[model samples]
Target: MKTQVVIIGAGPAGLLLGQLLYRAGIDNIILERQSGDYVLGRIRAGVLEQVTMDLLHQAGVDTRAHDEGLPHEGIELLFKDARHRIDLHGLTGGKQVTVYGQTEVTRDLMAARAAEGLTTIYTAAPVSLHDFDTAKPTVRYQKDGATHEIACDFIAGCDGYHGISRASVPGDALHLYEKVYPFGWLGVLADVPPVSHELIYANTSRGFALCSMRSEHRSRYYLQVASDQKVENWSDESFWNELRLRLDPEACERLVTGPSLEKSIAPLRSFVAEPMRFGSLFLAGDAAHIVPPTGAKGLNLATADVGFLSRALEIHYREGSQSALDRYSELCLRRVWKAERFSWWFTSLMHRFPENGEFGQKIQEAELDYLVNSRAASTSLAENYVGLPLESF
Candidate 1:
């Protein structure tokens, strides 16, 4: 097979990148190692910052996203069994977040692609690259245990955190930066409704617990846990009991239990591969950078990356130039680092320190108190949560 662009992974970054290029009158191929059904069922982030929503609208795929998704004006910070709401619009002037699952967005994009007649080769694993030094670059893959080749003008390595594309690139040419936090998240997708109108990020001595969503009838919640903690070790009874203690209190009715849909543990870390482009290959999303889920910024960051890369692809194919292509890395990193900082700050703020003395806990409490009361602090959180502008490549 041959095309102008080839995308790997079929996650948000890869699928959306393919759609944008298709709209630009450029043909592309997406090779994924997983089935479409599996991709759709994977539980992940749902909060969409205003900036990401705008890009989806611009890409013409936001029709269903706008209709089916819920619009949230702000988030609530609950601590010491008390609730405090931050009016994001009031704080940031006009920005608001939309509550839409990652899986839903992927399903919408995949459906739109089908309507527009874009084909993806699912269960296709890349074998190797043929050329990047010539006028055409190529990707060779094995699909259904058979070998195949895709000739392309460039490659978008959208395969996520543990994928091979980022590692296959030469180490000398790549600069790797990483931060591994002391904690991980025990994320649960339960058949329970959210306990509050807005997401509540609470910091208790128990650890950091974020009350979020997968849908109205379903709630996605997470609690900080030991990095080695396994989901199988956490029983249904224990999970509910923990939820009741840390999340449910006398101020609010206890969280109602629903069937446990899924549970998994993911490490919290920040990583970025500098200069996201090498030859005809470029990295986006988790393959390029990862932020702790505390701030709910990973999906938003990937959407932003594809937004920039798709525009650059448009220019490269339209103007017949390499200038824009050469700058992909520098451009995406600007926003990537900013998000990393925010995610780290949020994680540090909500998680307790093993070395904390009485003063450290007091300081954290003071900070949380200020975040709810101070306009400047709240606005900073609102601006980052609602979204930051995408950089142009």
Candidate 2:
């Protein structure tokens, strides 16, 4: 089989890229190692930036999102037993975020692809890329006891961190930078009204806690725990009890507890692989970088990456110029680094670090005080939180 572009993985990044390319009249095929149900089963963050929303509109999958997604103009921060509100809309001149689950986004993209009769092969395993360094690149995969080869002009590596896309790069060619944090987030999804109308981020003596929701009734909450923490050890009652201790009195009173629909513990880490382009193979989303989720930038970053990539590919096909394609890495890295800094800073400010001791606690408090009171500092936070603009090619 031959196509213009072969996209690996059927996650949001891969599916969204396929949709954009299809609209641009580019022939592309998506290969996924898992079934469609498995992809939607994986729970992820929901916060969506304006830029992401606009991209969805461009892809023609914004109908459901616009009808069901909840919009928030501000977030409340808890410190010193007091709750402070950051007007994200006001601080950023009417910019706001929407609470929409990543799963829903993937579902919308997948449905759009199916309606258009796009080519997406699921359960295509043992995939490999060859000759990416030269002009002609080909992808090989095994399915139904048979090996299939796809000759393509380019390959997109959206299979995520552990996938073969990044692994295919020679160690010497890829510069990897990573920092594993000392704590992890124990998250729970329950079908109950949220603790508040808007999300609340708490910095307390116990630990850091965030109260977020996918909709008005589906609440997603998180608590900072030791890196070695086990999900099986915490019962539903215990989890709620612990969460109450970390919240302010008012929030605790308003909090509603219920059976958890899903529970998991994920370690925090910041990782980036430099120069996202490896010859004809390009990496987007988790294949390129990862942020701790403190700033809710994980999915947003992936959207930005593919947005730039799709535009670059469009220019390459339409204008017959390689300038945008060559500049893809440079443009993506500039924004990727800024998001890394923001996630790192937000994680450091909210979590309790035993290694930092009392000094760290005092310093965090001082900074929180300044951040809430000073308009300049709050504006900076709002700007980064809403997300930095995509650079023009």
RMSD of each: 1.6, 0.6
Superposed model 1: Cα runs more than 4 Å off: 248-254
List, residue by residue over 169-245, the lDDT tens digit for candidate 2. 98899999999999999999999999999999999888999999999989999999999899999999999999999
Candidate 2: pairs in clash: none
Q: Which ranges of candidate 2 are over 4 A from the true structure? A: none
Worst 10 residues of 1 by lDDT: 245-254
Give the TM-scores of the predictions, in the order they appear.
Answer: 0.96, 0.99
Strongest candidate by TM-score: 2
Clashes of 1: 0
RMSD of 2: 0.6
TM-score quality measure for candidate 2:
0.99
Model 2: residue 256 alpha-carbon error in angstroms: 0.5
